[model samples]
Structures are given as structure tokens and as C-alpha cells.
Target: MSANDLPSLLSVALLARVGPARERLREALGQAGATLVLEEDPNTLELQVLRDAAPGAVLIALEPAIEDALERLDPVLGSPSLTLIFDEAELAARREGWEAQRWARHLVAKLHGHLDVLPPGSEQDGLLQPEPGLPTTPAQLHADAPLDFHVREAFDAAGDVPADGLYQAPDTLSEPMSLEEALAALQPPFSTPAAPSGPPPVPVSAPQTEPPRVPLGDHSSWSLVDDDAVAAVAPPPSATPSAAPPPSDFDIARLSLVDLEAERPADGAAAGAVLVLAGIGGPDALRRLLATLPAGLATPVLVHMRLDGGRYGNLVKQMARVSALPVLLAEAAEPVQAGNAYILPDDVGLAVRDRGLYFSADAQGVQVGTLPPSESAVVLLSGADAGQVDAVLALAGEGAWVAGQVGEGCYDPTAANAVVAAGMHAGEPPQLAQHIVERWGVSE
Candidate 1:
């Protein structure tokens, strides 16, 4: 069926070895916006029963226990209208909380053909990303007109300052002081004010030295309700008045390459490999992505996602089931092949040579800095470390095609979001695969 003809709420058939995994799969599918047509244990289910239900998709929680039963339903697996998705039963049974919710969002996105799962950040992800016409730089935050208007408004309103700015006249002042004396007593100490009135006036007899301090937060006042810590929260004003400093302490200029080192690509280095870095919600993403890749991609796919359990052998097997390319666990001192997938751990890394790169156990992880940027590519997926963001961006600056995962399924997109924020490309796994094919062109 054409993509446009796909259903809004896909009818799904659930098959598993009748246990907690089946129930978890049922709930997860429902949460992902799927309508369950049939839920049955694959070991006891009949093929004709599944065919008669006519589900748009079939979700199989695979395990060795149900292997023979699944083989009996091979005919149904080949149906054009049916989309078969296999997930690990152990993973499903254990999935819970936010991780399960993230998986559900990605599943719905896959079924519905949309990527709207937002990153777990403030609701204001787009706040700093203003359109072209809007203010982008710090100096533009206050421009000449707005600053003049605000300063003049404050100065003009300062004349009508009320008696005893924040502190009221003490009920039992031992000295029974005058109104001016009481006001003076509360002046400097009670610098910040509250109430629905203009702020207490500072005597402008001498020229005001320090530039005006901004309000504590987004509120339109110089006061903060935090009584316990009286320390200043706002940054002190800069000496230069010609150009306005950043509105907040964080300057966007920090991301610029002004302070970074200048490293050129090696003179005669050849194209190395396609490197993928993922975490948290990455296994599913990697599985889906690897399944679409052609066998003769002619570039080693070096996957460097860390699994806490160090199940690299299991990862290799999982990827091999879906991948057209030969997926293998990186071995010590082995020559990196042209069209194979390597699941490299932190201890293993590439050993650069005159011919090409090789997997070396002696090396300390895959170092992107050692690769020729012009001939390399880096893709950051969910849960990728933000610490490598600077190095990746530097490579992008040197002509490497860099991309980040955008949309649902990527649970921790901290590194991915950082890449996208810096104007790098962002898309779903399949979209990125297509780009890879288009950019590098494929073989037989």
C-alpha cells in the first residue's frame, strides 16, 4: 500500500510466547496509537486466524521458545499490506516508566508517519531560535529605542517614590526618628522593592556610575522574593557601553570556533567509515536504520553505542538479523572491512594506517579527531554524549556531513539537539539512510 493510504490508527496483531511480555506489548501498542485486532501466543496461534483478522501490522516479541511457531507463519510475513516488527521479549518485559513512554511515542510516529516527539527540555526549545527578522544577537536585545524608553520610564517614575520603600515605620522606634531619617535607614539595605508602585529613587545628584541591573528573572522588577540568600543573582554590567552585552549570562558566541584549534585534513587520507553514536533509546533506532541499508554500501558502519551490560555479542546478533550487511563485534587488530557493521566497545578503536583504518583493542575508543574530516561522516542519535559535541561540530566546519536524530524514539537527545541547534541536519533514521545513499551512491 502507498504511504498516503496508511491508516490513521493502524490495526495491529500481537504475537508473543504468552507471558508478561505479551501484556506489556499490548499496552505499549495501545499507548502508541495502535488498535489491537488479535493478541495471542505465537506457540499456539494458527496462521489462518491472523490472516482472517487482516491486521495492517504484526508485532512479534521474538524469543527462541517460539521459533518453530513463527516459521509456520512465513507466508503471512511476506504479505505486502502487513508490516512485521520484531522486538526483544526480554526488553519489552523490563521496559517501564519514561523509557516505555519514549518507545511508545516513536512507535506511534513510525505507524502514523510523523516525528513530533519533543525532547525532554523546557517548553521553550524554540525561544532562542528566532526567525531571521527577529533579534538574534545580544546587542539587539535592547537596541537604542527600547533601552531609552525603559531607562527614561524608570527615571521618570522614580520621582513619585513612596515613604519607607520596603520597610514600614517601626511600631516602636527607640529614637522615634523623623520621616526622612526612617527612609534613609531603610534606603541602601532595602535596595530592591515590592508592591504595585515605582521603585524608590536613588539620589542622582552625582552621575549614576553602575549601569542598570536587569530583573532577577523574566519579571519586570529588580526585586526577588528569595530572602534567605541576599547575594546578587544578576551579572554586573560591563564597562563598554557602545555595544550591549548579552541579555543573560550565557553568550551564544561561546559556540563559535574562535577559541578552537585549527586542524586541516591529512594530505592523502582516504574515506574511512560511517560512524554512528547512540545511547538510551538507540538500539531500536539502530535496528530500524541498519535494516534499510544495502549490503554493498562500501563503507564500514562503526557503531559506538555503549550498553551498560556490555552485551556487544548480543548487539551483533540483533543487528545481523535485520541488517543486509555483515554485522560483527569488533575484534582486536582486525582490518576494517568495506561493507560490514562493527559493534565497537569503549576499549576498542580504529588504528589508522596508510591503507585504511583497522579495529585495534589497544586503542582507547574511536577518535574522530584522528580521521580526515572531509571524507568522514558522524551521526549522533538518542543518548549520545554532549561532551563530543564540540569535536563533532569542528568536523562539520571542515566539510564533514554531520547529522543528529530529530523526532520521536530518541529518549535522550542531548547531543543530537546540540548538533541541530548549531544548524546541522536533523531527521529520522530512514531519512538519514536515504541521504547517505544519495551522497555516497550505492553498489550492486
Candidate 2:
């Protein structure tokens, strides 16, 4: 489709298994003539998105597989509309963290380019550059050209060497000669060529001996005896002070990305995908958590959850029914299909590597201390033409889609707060509703 056509084409990458719903989605795409690309592997989805072409695309993750695609395709692809689909009854089921991480990486890859990283040499002021027509070659510049040269010249003028001496040149013999000839030439002609000029008439033999002694007058002797003599004496040792302590770690994080927008949606298409994460829950919770979102969110819902219990994904699916947005679960390492929810597996986590969601062998954990499961957030830019697009979603007022269970206990409310703080420290404002709830002490 043309670039313009693609934006309005209702493009979506469907990630779902073959089944009645899958077939139905395919039929719907066919009927609507939407540019729907069905991917069984998220890796393929990531790979298929070329940087320049992804701006108008949409991503529908019907299963966990979409994470793999996001990871693989992040580097070159842009963030697209994302949706997740799954059964509504499994609210308590554990979801995998890796899956959420993959999705986050996808978002990161898609939006990271938007970060306001200063170009080289821009951080500080007062850095000077050579004026126009100034010598570009180092050889032409003098070591002390601007300040010391003139001062040194003036000092030389006051010394015994006359200024005129600067203009004189040393004499040199032009012709080559054998040692004997050179010696003959130098011999008496060198007979000490006439003694050089310029010295005064002091006799060389005169000795520097003392003159006849005359005792000093009593006045000189009296001055010496009455003086208060001041002699130099070694001073006592002074006390040494202890060193000061180093700055706190918070000081470092403050210099980092605290409270910054890490990324933003590149276009309307991306805005649509961002809608999934606008509330404390997923597509299902849209109605209760928020009021009136833009039309982009209501059109199609994309789910990308990184919970250890599959139940949350199921709950989200149930809640999606209450809103106008469609919702479901995505599969692991599968291509995302349009108009469906994709759920991640609860056993192992997922990540976006290359261009798709790949299942990680590692188990999920929780958010603790200052570190959170930022890996998922870090990797999502895999195929993305943009970087940090996920950060932009919140800027557009849509919350982010996250599957917390990556570290020690990501689901704990305290852990959520830590993640939010970490994101804030990283300069990306926390865009997840759950993170906000934790920060504000809100509960369902």
C-alpha cells in the first residue's frame, strides 16, 4: 500500500494460532480489505517492518509470540498499533515476564530515537572554535602567539643583546674542502681572524682582589649591634583534615533521566497501539479506569502483558469486552495478527529479540530496590525505526502495556513503585497506570 494508503489501510500484524477466531479475523481483514499481515512468529513481524515503512503499520499480538517479533524488528521498524487477545476467564493465571520484556523492548526500539540526546559538543557553553580564516593547520600557529610572544620580545630589547642583533646573519663557508685544505683555510686566516669587536678595555690579567682595607666607621658597627635579628626557624606541623564523603547514588540518578519522557508515538498508527496501556489493567479495564480516550484507542485493542500469573491476561480479556476496544492474548515468538489479544506464557518470560518476541528460558521475578525489569523496556527497540516510542504513549495520554513478573516480585505494589521511580530516574516518566497506582497508593 502507498504510505498514505497504509495509514488509513487499517494495517495490523496478527499474532494468533489457527482456530475459529483466527479464521474469523482473517476473514474480517479480507472483507475490510485492510492490509493485515498474519505472523505466527513475532520474529517475522519484527523483521518484516523496514524503518521507512513502519510508520503507518499496526501490530496485533494475539499471543505471546509478538514479543519475539518486537525484539527482532525494533532496530529498523517503528512502533505500530498493538493489541492483545485472550480468553476472559483466566484473570488469575500467571503470565511470563520475558514476554512483557519483549514487548517493552519493541516499544523502546520504536521510540528511543525520540530521546533528546544532545549532539556532540552541545552539553556545555563557552566552548570556543577558531574564527573564520583562522589557520586550520596546527603547524602555522605559534606556541605563544597570543600573549607571551610580545612580552618576551620587549624583555629581550632591555637586555645586553641589541634589537639590531636580531637582523644579523651568521657567516658560512660555501665550498667543500678536504680536511687538509679546510685546516689550511682555517689556519692563520683563521689566524684568529681579527679579534671580534664590541668588548670594553678591561685588562684580562687584572685580578678580582680586594682593595686596601679601611676599617668601617663606628656608625656601621653601631647599626649592626643594635639590630633585632630575625632568623628562619622551622615551623611546627599543621593538622591535616579528613576527606569528605562521596555524593549519594540519588545524586547520580538525578543527573540521569529522572521524570523525562523517554519516547513518544511517531504517528496516529502508533497512537492506536499505545492505548492498550492507558489504565491500571489492560484492554478489558479500559472502561473503569479511564474516561474518554481518543478514537485511536477504541478502534482496536492490542494486549502485551508481562505478568507471571496468566490470570491477569484473562482478566484483561474479560474487561476488554466492556469497552469498545477488542482484546485478547498474544503467543510467544509468534507473528502478531490484527484485531486480537496475545497472551504470554506464565512459566518462562519473553523478550523482543531481532524483530519478534522470543521466549526466554529464565523465570520471571519482581521489581525491587532501584532496578526493575527494564530489560523488556530496553530491548523493544529491536526493529523499531524509532526509539522509546513506548515513553511517548503516555505523553499521548495512553498508558503502557507491561507484563511485570520479571524480577523478584514485580506484582507487589511496592515493587511497582520502585519501577516507577526507576523510570523516573531514567528520565522517562512512568506511563503505566499500575505504576501510578502504586505511587499514589491506589488499589482496585
Candidate 3:
């Protein structure tokens, strides 16, 4: 089946273990546009009911305790047409903030077989599109044009003067007051009559003489002096002379050129390893790819899949069930070995050191561009994030063997499609597996 052939509405049978996890999964499936045809507990699920309901897909929230129940439902599991999806129970229980957003995206990708799941009213057609012509320039102000009515009225009012020429009145005013009349109204009336003023007194005669200066020698007690007293005092010296500590032998060797050369990885050896990046519909794709890999493959496999904090344990167990090689969660400071598949944790970064992989506590996590391109094989699987496309392309340009999952199986091919468009290898999960097997020359 091709991606174009995917059903618009999926009738899903949910055989999930009951808890907050099951409810969270149900909500996510609803958001992804999946119609729940039947919901039943994994413990009590019967093959007859599954046949009767006839759902297109069966979503199972795998828990460690439900292995016995799954074994009994082998008949339903064996159906070729049914798409079996296994999710870690604890991971599905996370339904808050960014975790909820990621869970919804993954759920939609798994059920709808595509990454472009938008909310009801968020369709591109509903958005306002820009007008086809150039934007209309704002109407320019004309300097030669007449002033606005209010501005002209303000200028005319200021210029209008009364007949006295001492006061200006607004054109709207009926009467204007004179400056003399306004001042006379503000002054108080003289109540008592003033006595007859005597004749003005004669101007006083003036005699001026210059004052004399005193000699500096007359004040003998006060003298000007420089601050030479402070310079006379000296700071105290140390009680004993101390010698510097002798340089250590260890420090001398560390600075030598031999030490720097020893740190680098050997030339002509495989500096690169296999890196697998996936998201939403990656679990099944990963399982299919891992199953075809030989037991003693030379290239070390590193997998980075988006999952909740506590889901790594369950994922390792689930992948081991179908993978031909051992699947294990990668640990910090551990060396990457051949034939074993390592699942990368979300909180750490993976790096190559001494020809082996090592993990660091980097919040940004493992970046694809940080790996050595000449020695690495990168597989872009289903549901890979679109944000990592550029980094993956850079790796391809640096001579890394890059492959992407294509066709119906890749529900979220956003990152994979980017790699394919850049002229890298493109194929389904099984074909990707075959490519890796042949590239590394595994004795399969």
C-alpha cells in the first residue's frame, strides 16, 4: 500500500491496559482523527471479538505483566492486514505541556500515516492570504496644499489683533480687553490720601580709596608645606622568604606533543558508526530494520527515537522481542561495540572517542552533525523530525552513507523526504535494512 492509499478515517481496535495511560492514548487517537471501533482490556480480549469488530489497526499499550495475555491473542496478532502498534504504557501516560504535544503528533502520525495533522480550524485554506498586488503606499502629505481647518483657525486667531494693537483676540471671540484696562482692574484702590512730599534730598558726596595688601611674612605661625611626611614611612616586610612549589612531573608530560597525538582516533579505520533517527511511527520501522541485521555486524548501531523518560526500559524489551541482535539502552561512558544496538536516551549526547561511542550530559542531546561523516552510516527512519534535515544533509555532503525511509510505511517522512530530495538513498524499512547489511558486509 502507498501513502496516497491511506484511509481518511481509521477504525482502530484499542486493546490497552487500563490506567491513565490508556485514557491518554484514547484522547491522542481522537485528536489524530481515529475512530475507536472497540475498546477492551488486554486481559479479557478474545479473538472472536477482534474478528467481529474487524478494525484496520490494533494499538496495544505493552506492559511487562501482560505478556501472558498477548501470547493467548496470537491469532489476532498473526493477521497480515492488521497494523500492530506497540507503545510503552508509562510513556503514553504523559499528557501535559510539551510531552502532550509530542504524544499527539506521534499518535496522529501512527494512525493517519502522515505528519501533517493540523487542528480543525488550522487548515491552510482557512488562513488569510496576502493580496496579489504591491502594498498600497500610505497617502503622502502634500506640502503645497492648504492647512487643515483646525490648524488654519489656530494661526488666524493668533494673528488677529484688536483696534488698540496691544491684545490679540480669537476670531470666535465677540469682545477683546485692552492691556491698560485689564491692568487697572487688577490694582487695589488708594484708601488714604498721601502727605505732601518734601523736596528731594541732595545727593550724598562720595570719597573712594584703594585698600592695601598685607605681607606674607606678617603671619609667621601659619606656613604652607608639602605632604612629605607620608613618604617617610615604609611598609612592613614579610617575616620569612617563601620559595615557589616545584613543578610536578605529571604536568610536564601532559604538555608534550606525544600525548596530544595519542588522543586522536587512528587513520584509515572506521571513525563512523550507524546512526538511526526516528519518531512517531519509528518503533515498527526500527523493529523491521533490526530484525534483518546479522548477529555479528561490524558497524555499531546507535538509535535515537523520541520517547518519554521512563519508556527506555520497556522499549529495549519490546525491540529485543523482534530484533535479531541484542537491543540495549545506551549508558554514559560505555564504549560502543559491534553487533549490539544502542538506544539513545533523551537527556544525553553521544560522541565518538577512542574509536568508540561515549555519552555526555548535554541538554541539547546528540547532534547528527557532530559525528564523523566518513565513517558513519545515517538512516533517516519514519517519523523523523523535520528540524534535523539540514544536519543530516551536512553529514551526507561530508561523505557519510545516508538513507531515508520512503513510501507507505513512513508515516512522518518529513526528515526522510528531505534526505531523499538531496539525492541520498531512499527505500522502505526492509530495503534500508538490506542496504545497511550489504554496506557493512554482515555475514547474514
Best by TM-score: 1
Higher lDDT: candidate 2 or 3? 3
* lDDT of every predicted structure (CA atoms): 0.76, 0.36, 0.75
Which pairs in model 1 have colliding backbones?
Answer: none
State model 1's lDDT.
0.76
Candidate 1, residue 340: the lDDT equals 79
**Global lDDT of model 3:** 0.75
lDDT of 2 by residue, 240-308 (tens): 334556666555544655666434322211112222322122332333322222222322223333443
TM-score ranking, best first? 1, 3, 2
Query: TM-score for each prediction?
Result: 0.49, 0.22, 0.46
Residue 395, candidate 1: how far off, in angstroms?
A: 2.7
- Model 3's number of clashes is 1
Look at candidate 3 and give me any clashing residue pairs.
272-375
Query: Cα deviation of 154 in candidate 1 (Å)?
Result: 19
Query: Any runs in candidate 1 off by more than 4 Å, and if so which?
Result: 1-24, 30-270
Count steric clashes of candidate 2.
Answer: 141
